[model samples]
Target: MKNIIENLKEYALETIEAEAEAVSQLPGIVDDGFGEAVALMARCKGRIVVSGVGKSAVIAQKMVATLNSTGTCALFMHSADAVHGDLGMIGPGDIVLFISKSGNTEEVKRLLPFVKKMGNPVVSIVSNRDSFLGTHSDRLIYVPMEREACPNNLAPTTSTTLHLVVCDAIAMALSRFKNFTAEDFGRFHPGGSLGKRLYMRVEDVFDKTNQPRVSEDETIKNVLITISSHRLGATVVLGPDGDLRGIITNGDVRRMVENGKDINTLQAKDIMSRSPKTVDKSALAVDALRMMEANNITSVVVLDGGKYAGLIHIHDIMREGIQ
Candidate 1:
């Protein structure tokens, strides 16, 4: 058992080192061809049709997703399927990007002729520049590798990593060329937590129906009731003319009791914290979270146009998966 564990660890370390070495060689591979491929894709009038066979096909799908998310229109078509009716998905204005390690896969070889006859620009990420796919491509992004990370050197291990990295590089280059901003990314990823953080404001998360408040002269029992009813752990204290005054929390009640003070004789203003943390209702929810974290508080008073609005709690922000 000990020998088996030791061998597994050694093999893992060797695989990591081999892949890292192969990836380090990529900087030298980024010549004028890579730049030309980026420019071609950036200027493409239609979607980028990324196609590959075997493990390269999987990387091609990931490339499509990255491109679409980063402001580029892209789609994936399996090289094997492209020989069938799937070839119709490629439009006249689209660019075809083929990924392969040996540059001579049977499916890629079969599909290359059809893609070339369609008059679409062909870009390839290949290791063997002399092979069929590499020689037929209009622009070749060569990824020269020594061997795979597999012990038998048969599996698509290091080569796929190189392919994925190159695809990511191309996507980022196109993204930068188009000046894609985070706001644009947020538009693309509106349903995820990332989009919520980028666009969700305090008004979106704060409860408008549960604005707990109490008069400054209200009894401690009524203040406690307001805080308990709202379930926000705190309540705002309003002045005589309904102006913002201070805040009272369950902790304040507990401290008042712990001090052996007569809680029944005290009013809301007597035990409330005069200086409370506050946030504008129009502010971002992430900013509210930052305020809560910095002050070590669980909630903050929400103000709308310099007037008392409501309370925003940490759990409210957390419930929406906004850090």
Candidate 2:
């Protein structure tokens, strides 16, 4: 058992070293050909139809997803399925991109003739530029590799990594060329935590109906009742004509009690904090969270056009997974 465990570590290290070495050679392959391929896709008026077989087919789907998410339109067509009937998804202006380790897969070879018959421009990522798929392509992005990470040089390990990296490079290049911004990314991914951080405003997350406030001359007993009833841990003190005055929190009440102050003799104005942290209702929720974290407070006053609208608690931001 010890012998097997020791050999496992050695084999794993060898695999990693071999794959890293192959990846190190990828930069040299990104020459004029790579740029041309990216430019061709950028100029394409329609979606990028990426097709492959076996492990390459899985990588092709991932490429399609990345391209679509990064502002480039793309579709995945399995080479085996394309020949069977999926070729109908290809449009006239669409560009056909083929991924292959050998560039000579029988399924892709069979599918290529039909793609050519449709008069679509063909782009290929392949290790062997002389193979059928590479030789026949209109644009070629060559990815040369020493060997697979597989001990027998059969599994699609290092080669697939090279293919995926090349696809990502192409997607990122196109994204930059199109000037795709974080706002655009947020639009594409609206349901995730990342999207919420980028676009969710304080108005969207804070409770609107829970605007707990009290008059400055109100008794301290009522201020405690307001804070307790609203369950916000704090209350805003407003003056006549609804102008902002001050704020009182549970901590203030605790301190007053500890100091043995005459609770009955005081009003809201006497015990309230003169200044409190606040955020604009239109500001991003993530920004509000930052303010809360920086101030070491659990809530902040939400202002709408300089008027107190509501309170945004740290719990509210946390509930939305905006952190």
Candidate 3:
């Protein structure tokens, strides 16, 4: 049993090391062909159509997904399905990427004529430049020669890893060529933790019940009540005309008491900070958090079109996993 466990550990490590070494040699193998392929896709007017068969097909699907999420429009057409009616998904001006490690996958090679007839550029990522798919392609990006982790060199181990790395590199290059920003990426995501971090607005964080607000003329005692009631650490002070006046926080209350001031005689305006930090409710919550960080504060007053909206606490951002 101990010998079996040791063999298992060594086997896994060997697989990882083999794949890593294959990936490391990719830069040396990259040449003008890869650059031309990226330039073709970057200049493509329509979506990129990625097609492959078997293990390479799975890599193609992942590549399509990454391309779409990173601002480059893309779709996956299974090589076998493309031979059916899936070829209709390809439109004029589209770029088709054919992924095949051996460059001779029958299903992938069958689409070469159809891709050419569509008048779209066909780029092949293959290990054998002399194979049918590579010879028929308009351009070829060669994958470095890889020996599979399979003892018999038959399983798609290192080859598939290299395919993933190559696809990701192309997607990132296209992303840089288009100058895609985090905000652009957020628009596509919009559901995961990444979307929440990038797209969450101050309005989403601060709402009516959590808005600790009090009139400027309200007594310090009333201000403290609002702050404590809402549990937002501070109260937004407003004027009689509903304009922002100042903010009174628990710290202000503590300082006033420490200074031996007549807490009973003070109004909300008396102990409040006139230049309290404020954020537009429409602003990104991440940006509001940056404001809080820069000002060394824990909360800020939220305004909607220059009017008081609510209060945003640092804890609110934290709850969204922004940090």
TM-score of each prediction: 0.96, 0.95, 0.85
| Stretches of candidate 2 exceeding 4 Å from the true structure | 1-7
Model 3 C-alpha lDDT per residue in residues 194-227, reported as the tens digit of each score: 8877899988876656667888778887888888
lDDT of each: 0.93, 0.93, 0.89
lDDT of 1 by residue, 1-323 (tens): 99999999999999999999999989998888788888999999999999999999999999999999999999999999888799999998999999999999999999999999999999999989899988999999999998999999999999999999999999999999999998798788888899888889999999988899999899998998889999999999998887888999889999999999997899998998999999999898999999999988899999998889999999999999999
Candidate 3: which pairs clash? Answer: none
Best by TM-score: 1
Question: What's model 3's lDDT at 151?
Answer: 81
Q: So what's the TM-score on candidate 2?
A: 0.95
* Superior by TM-score: candidate 2 or candidate 3: 2
Please list the residue runs of candidate 3 whose C-alpha ends up more than 4 Å from where it truly belongs after superposition.
1-7, 208-210, 215-217, 239-245, 251-275, 293-297, 304-307, 318-321
The residue ranges of model 1 lying beyond 4 angstroms of the native Cα positions read none
Candidate 1 structure, TM-score to reference: 0.96
